[model samples]
Target: MQNSTRKRQKEELNYLRDKVQSLEKELETKRHQLMASKGEDKENKAVRVQLRGSRARAMRWQRIAKHQLVEKQRAEMQNLQLKESLMDQIKLARSLQKLLKKNASKKVEGTEAAQLQARLEFGNYCSAASEDSLYESLLRDMDAVYAEVDTVCARHPVMQNMEEGSDVSSLLEGETDALSLEATNSKVVPFGMEETCAAVWRCLSKDHVKLADGTYHSVASSPDCIRAKAITTLRVNTTTARMQMRFAMKKYVEPGRVVITLESASESEGPRDLLHGLKMMQRAWVVIRPVPFEPEDNEFDGDLPSEETIIQLCMRLTPSVSATVLDIPGQRAGAITELLLAAVHRNLGWLFQTVENILMEHDFGATLL
Candidate 1:
């Protein structure tokens, strides 16, 4: 019994040792697992920090982009305002320059009229003397006046039709007849020059008409032959048969036309009734367009010359009467025609000089041209 007891105790002691070894192995495995879990936790913390930094960088860039876009828009708006301001200044300057030029022209015209009046008085004195020398002197003075008139009329660049050796009277005769016959419609009166000669004036009727501003009145000798008595700031009476009209100027529009567009026809007409034999004046407008010079007639300076650069100045008289009434080229029409011709004759040189000066002085003029 003692031997059996000892063998059993030995077996129990071996089993106890095996149990302890198994427990030691399990504890080592648990230690290794805890160490690995701690390392994973540290790695997770670093990943979270890196993600925060990246987000901050992205947010910074987004703010910068937004700021830049705002600044860009502000600069664009400022630039646009500056451009508009510059354009306004340019227009104002141009208008001021034109006003100054017009004033100067008026002064020059007044001086010229005085001199012409003096010369006429002198001529009359010479003719009244009835002596050979006096008569000769008067004749010479009259010739000089004619020469002056001719010289003035001949100098226009637009007078290309006259240079073709055609007489001005002949050119006007047929056109004038047509104008006289068709007084109801509007017309285009062309002033053409051939080469370096005189301008050929031709009046031809057309359909389209622009308008002129300001109220005007007319006194006619007869309804059949209407005559202009009073124009704006200019009046002519029976006592003074002298026809002196001025202050007409052409404002050029682009594409070879100068347009003077007045208010609508209804607004331009005067009162219907007048004392004596007179008719109320109606609307009027003037148009000047460049007609191309014929190739044969053009004076070339290495540039293409068309009649359009040469010109046609037209005056359209819009009477209040309709197709039912009588219409013919009248004295009023003649007066307007004379006024335009004379005004241009006097002012063309001045106009050209002013334009040239403006072109030289300002970049705007060059750019516009």
Candidate 2:
């Protein structure tokens, strides 16, 4: 019995040793797993902190951008307000200066009017002395135009219609019909030379009749002839008489420059209104030239011609009404001259504006031959 009991105790002791070994192995695995879990937790915490830092930077930059935008808008508003203030001040200063100038010129303007009132005789508007002066001035203008045309023509393959300016001048000198042949106002419109010339020609040549009332009312016209380099016809009917008018145009080209010259088609013929013993004649050396592209900054206080076309109008009117029209006791010669000049100027303005409007509306293409 004693031996059997010793063997069983030995077996129990071996079983106990095996259980202790298995328990040690399990504890080692659990320790390794715990260390790995701590390492993973440390990595996860680092990732979370990095994400928060990035979000903070994003929010800061967004705020900075918004502030900058507000500041830029404020600056623009202030700049615009400053510009408006400056403009207002400039306008006020100009108004005051014009008022002062008008006040200063009033006296001289009165004296000038009085002197002009005593100029001519009973039945005549222009004196014989003015004829020589007018002829000379027109000749000068014609000479300038001829020289320009001849210069361009010499280089041209086809010699365009060549006429001597002197021939026209001599013919004009002999005509008893010229009431006044003088240089009139011109305009420099911002447009192409050829286009504007063509427009002007079209306006003059078309059988367009308009009746205007002013100094001498009821002037109606139907173009029976047009003589610009591009030829057509228009006949005029007025209260005073019937007018047979013709125009001629010539175009010349040079490097970067275009010139158009318009004059009477027939030297022997002039536009007239048949009032008893009054034969009205008009002679013109109107020129249209393109201005070179450049800045015109000359201190000479007037208008500067730098770009686009130069428009010179050569239409005028002679009073065929009774001599009593100017014989009113209170009538100043300045008033008569102003009235006549204003009428001519108004017509010219309307003509130009009409052409410009047509061009804009109809897309009027330039037709040059």
Candidate 1 error regions (>4 Å): 1-231, 238-308, 318-369
- lDDT (Cα) of model 2: 0.38
lDDT of 1: 0.29
The sequence of per-residue lDDT tens digits that candidate 1 reaches over residues 209-298 is 111211223222221112222222111122111221111111224354433322111111222221111211122222334444566655
TM-scores, all candidates, are: 0.20, 0.33
lDDT of 2 by residue, 112-139 (tens): 2332232223124332354334333333
Q: CA shift at 334, candidate 1, in angstroms?
A: 13
> Distance from true position, residue 132, model 1, in Å?
64
RMSD in order of candidates: 43.2, 41.8
Which candidate number would show the highest TM-score if scored against the true structure? 2
Q: On a 0 to 1 TM-score scale, where does candidate 1 land against the true structure?
A: 0.20
Model 1, backbone clash pairs (residues 3+ apart or across chains), number? 19
